[model samples]
Target: MSEPTMDHHRWGMVLARPRGLLTAEPFWSETADGIEEGLQHTQILFFLHQVPGLQEELEVYRRWSAQGFVHGVILVNPLVNDPRPALVDQLGLASLHAGVETPAPGSASIVSDNVESTRRVLERLHALGHTRIARVSGPSHLAHTHIRNTVSRQIAQELGISVRIVAGEYSEESGRRATAELLGLPAAGRPTAIIYDNDTMALAGLATASALGMQVPDDVSLVAWDDSASCQLASPPITAIAQDVHAFGRTIAQCVRRIESGESSFEVPEPAHHWLRRASVAEVSPPR
Candidate 1:
């Protein structure tokens, strides 16, 4: 019996942390759907790996590239000092990256304006008189997370507001722990507003606040990033920064198609992040 050969007609997307952002909500699923819809003739193959090392993951991509299993690959959640870009270039493969602004010269990139978006979030909090704000951020190593954190601190200093940030793994458990720690601070030192890097953490924060007998808005205002249906469905409906994941997916797919056609480098318009005001944030009142 002979081994089956590679399928050059297929495109690949490699993702990590599939449990939280990927399968926990419909946003990523919608993105996947959009990708397939955009590529009528090409089959999209999704590889979700639960690994602790990125080098191992890159090895998988390298093998696929060498075997010609996929025409191109999409990489997400880029890290600082990312080696994947160089690896892909060495392999002579077409690649696209999300959550990264400046990819390697030969690869394309899709990314949101994190600086502008973080400034907008801080501005909103400041307008509500949230002088002390706390942020529950995702992993510190990810390029997107670093961008958000840096911009947040810079904006807070400019606004003359105090800000505290705690690291999380973008999981419900991490969210709960971060929220508990933030809420445990002395009343005078505690933040009046809290922002989460994603909806899962925001939901956990809501639950943690409830357990502490704290009222939303009245005690602590809450905001979430990467808005999804889950955010709107939460009690009081979390305030969030919304991005069109479906459109983002379609754009990546289009870029992949272009790369497949021998285009070396091109730009894909990243979806805009906009704040959606809801019941979670309220104007602070002066003490009696």
Candidate 2:
């Protein structure tokens, strides 16, 4: 029997750590849209649901390869001790990794400066006089998350600010829960500024703060990881670290195109990420 050949005009991706509303989530959706735009002619599809573990993801890859369902795959949210790189290579699936700084032996990657960017966020918050801060971060296992954790810790210590970190699953519920827990603490112990992992969670956290009679930026400040239309249209626009998600997606698509065109493996640097200052962040007041 002949081996399965490339599935013409088709490529696949599975959302590694999905936000609650995968379809509605602006960042990923926008990124996917960009990928489509970059692909121009090729049809691209994203597997939106969470696939649980590497074995499952690999299984998906195997089935897809065996059936010739995809020409390649775009992987995001690389895990700590990731084996997908080597595994994908072994399975003969053309792959491109987004959000990876260092890829495995002979694999393609798109790198981002999560460490420096995270440090910059903390530095900005500290500059605003936010002393006691809290971070509602995404899943702990993601490589990006790991980098942020390390950087946040180091920067917080260097700046002499107290930072409490909590894990979330990129859901509104997780944000609400984490925010409530932080706000319920004694005033002296509670964080005055909260940094959320995504816009959805940030919006929920803001509402949670308000429901508890807390005034945004006055009683507490917030900074979201990804900027969104919803974040901007909120009661007070959310302060966010904005990256051109669409451009990043398009870049991913371009890399895949290059790989398919016989460019084996190469590293593509991620686009710039910057802060979107808005009403949600305010300078801390001097104690009475």
Candidate 3:
């Protein structure tokens, strides 16, 4: 088969992760490395803007699409009722969306199975004898957060576990504040285990737990989504849902290459997410 020709030599990606993720988090850094590796001849440009509102993202896409500044673009952390897909279709732009289940008519997607992974984590906690659990989730606007929160609550109900959810901005500060709030509840009402949406927040939760004089896996357990080296570096290490973020990036790059080559029927496989057991969780003891 003949190789597809790319209209533009440069591709672009806009990321909406916490600041310093590319440098601080191995997952983001490794994914960026993978994207670079997957590029054959075309140059990829990245716009690192943390939490740029949906409207701002739309403008960036519009300006770039209109100017032909980039041959293609990748969008990360899509919102509920996202308009990027429709905008991409209208602008005749070549694009890919990461972690979005429903792509616009003209774009392709590389997504994680949020619902399944969340269920697995919750099930493991329940099996460990934890009855009261809490989650520190990312902003409610992102589709993945909503999916995870929904699945978490649903499975907790099914398992007859008590669940509490707190919202965060995917920031360490928010994680710290949320952790403090959860820990402040009456001893009988506090959760025995806490789940964070990301490793950064998980680390913050660990710190907060320490400041509050709580022992992990004894007084409370910690788990995080998006596993990274930092998870293993903690005092007790952390349990996490590990996803192949590097592979996720490479898949997005591949999809962009295919779209650039004029391929219309492309499907990026959903990346797998699984539990990574560590020292963070322990079996609950029978109350006296």
Candidate 4:
């Protein structure tokens, strides 16, 4: 099939963070080629996520749609949840579908199952005989927190377990603060296990536990998601759920291709999380 191309005056895009540490340069160069050949000069709008004024960028995109100059907006970071509600009350759900002046049929997004993955990590904790468990979650602004929080609550209810949730912003500092908070609880209130959303937070938790003279799987067990290189290099290797990020990027690119081709939005197949068996968890011992 021939590659689809947009007319000079036809298409526009509203990109977010297309040039970040996470972005692959070659892929972006290809995307730039498509936009240049397929769009009117005024039709393309690129907004970096770290830009000072996001609202202003979105406003211009909204205006393009309002004036019927653009077909729709394509967000680069498909993982991030809707920020319109918090950013602009005028641009709520209703306005989104109608104001864009395009049918919502082809709108697509992609994200990992934060809830199910966290549940798996929690189940591993339960298997280790950990009754008291705590969670260090990433920022609440994104939809990832919503999924993780819901799944955690469900698992805890079914297993008759309790989880203490500490909010962190996916940074070492936030991780440290959360770990300190977890350690401050009374002996009886302290969790026998702690889980983090990402690998970085997990490493911080381990460091904090060591500072408090707690040994992994001896005093408390540890678990986290996204098995990064740091987890493998730790003194006692960490157990984690690993996602194929390269495959994830390719899948997202495919999804974008489908949308660009005017195809219906389709759900991407669920990516399996690989469980890395390691020495972080030990069988729970009964009270001495």
Candidate 5:
């Protein structure tokens, strides 16, 4: 097919996130909000959509490219060996990605410091004297999820502690199920503390633990990634890894600006995140 006419455009850029209740979470929503605010003063027609699936996403790119209706596409919830980046290149659409594990060969990236974040979360738990830990992680194929699991395992080995990761789909049901499974393990094998990949799951885990008659921090400690009002408003506010998500979204906007300005592919600098101590974490109690 002949090259896209490149003569007309209906939208300045687009972003498509994976379809799920997870997409309704604070992280992606806030990021979109920030990007919009960041681009507010300009006329960069930004489009954020929750397409049906991967194939639909690719089709959006193709349709938009064919119509010369989109100038670029933002890729989020990237997976290991993600194909969207390459597809964007194939369509000659400018692009930006929200991850770095598999770099977008020709796109600007706002790489979250997942490895560092994972380390900080683990180190904080370890320092509190919790030796047996478990994490309720997101889908296994997500690049960030895999990175967190791998890094957490490495840190666990270094600390000589036991760490187990359970697969979760970033939903209430998954959280409840995974938490029950972890908490049901024999006393000798159960974790003393738990980490959740998102506040939604974390909240569910907290409820599940309580439904099972376990007290947060007292019976089982909890930590959540991607802090939110729900996490903060829980019975005993859950400890969480907090980042300036609004600022993060603005940063992605900046990357979009720079990418449009013809800047070379580069990683946008992201602010560091920290573990927010709350009522949900405690040093492991002495064994009877």
Candidate 6:
């Protein structure tokens, strides 16, 4: 006769955005199971795969949490020291409360260690006889850009190789523009090899080289960081670092579980960077 004692174990959740980078269905289904098992009045899960960026969506999660729509939120891709810190801080200050609130009082992030990954990738290029290499980095404001550029520069300097850098957004168009800029440089000033932050940029760079009547490996070798599907079908089939995106998604879901159990910090093994050797690189010959 007692109103069924509210399931104290129930804790609702709100997920951040599109989870998979390489594939989706597998993680979506696994995450759905987590949601069902956690729905016992102690948990209620609501995912936001359609939301824009981290800060904006965190605010939405706070609103719904305050209205009892969800007890907690499972967010992703919250790059720290972000350009939009003010927005994130403001939302955090507004959401602090008795029980339902931003769990950590700030954005919690789970991301691949991009800097170390890039460093290893650069080392791979160096081993392949790429001495004079250039970098096509992502936008300056993003944390991934900062990490990749820092590692690239540090490694290039240590190896005594000349490195050139061109900045662009993480889009194919940005990659095209950056590539054109590199090609515009005099042949004497240009590096013999180019590395891009993502597969999108690498693929675009290949097109730009073709437009300029240049042959990859013979004219300029190319390497990309993220291993996307398009990277494999390019004329020469780009060499790239293939990440386990399915593992990334599953890790985020697991982080949420730990946070709910009063464990504020969870550590994941840094992703190891591997080079997929293809036809994009060529051996350099001494000048006559």
RMSD of 6: 6.8
Q: Can you give the TM-score per candidate against the true fold? A: 0.92, 0.92, 0.90, 0.69, 0.92, 0.73
* Per-residue accuracy of model 3 over 1-288 as CA lDDT, tens digit each: 554444475677666654555555577677777787677566555443444456667787787776667776777777888877778768876677777765445447776678778888888888888889999998998999999889888998899888899998778888899999999999888999999998888999999999999999789999988898889889899998888888877787788777767775455765798889899888896550
Those runs of model 2 whose alpha carbons end farther than 4 Å from true positions after fitting are: 1-4, 17-20, 42-54
In model 6, state the lDDT of residue 234: 74
Q: Score residue 113 of candidate 4 by CA lDDT.
A: 61
Tell me how candidate 6 scores on lDDT: 0.61
Give the Cα error of residue 230 in candidate 6, in Å: 1.6
Clashing pairs in 5: none
Write the number of the candidate with greater TM-score, choosing between 2 and 3. Answer: 2
lDDT of 5 at 227: 92
Over 4 Å off, model 5: 1-24, 102-106
Q: lDDT of each prediction vs. the true structure?
A: 0.81, 0.84, 0.79, 0.60, 0.81, 0.61
Local error of candidate 5 at residue 95 (angstroms): 0.6
Residue 214, candidate 5: Cα error in Å is: 0.7
lDDT score, candidate 1, position 14: 67
Number of the predicted model whose lDDT against the real structure is largest: 2
> Model 6: per-residue lDDT, tens digit, 12-85?
33333333421322333444454454443535353434454555565665565345444344433334353333
Residue pairs whose backbone atoms clash in candidate 3: none
The 10 consecutive residues of candidate 3 with the worst lDDT sum are 43-52
The TM-score of predicted model 5 comes to 0.92
Residues 153-198 of candidate 5 have per-residue lDDT tens digits of: 9999999888999999888888999999999999988899999998
Local accuracy of candidate 4 as per-residue lDDT tens digits, 219-270: 7777766776678888688877776654554454455445546554545543
Tell me how far the alpha carbon of residue 81 in candidate 1 is from the true structure, in angstroms, after superposition: 0.9
lDDT of 1 by residue, 108-153 (tens): 7775588888999999889877889999998887888898888889
lDDT tens readout by residue for model 2, 80-191: 9887777777777788888886766667789888888898999998888888999999888888888888889999999988999989878889999999999999988899
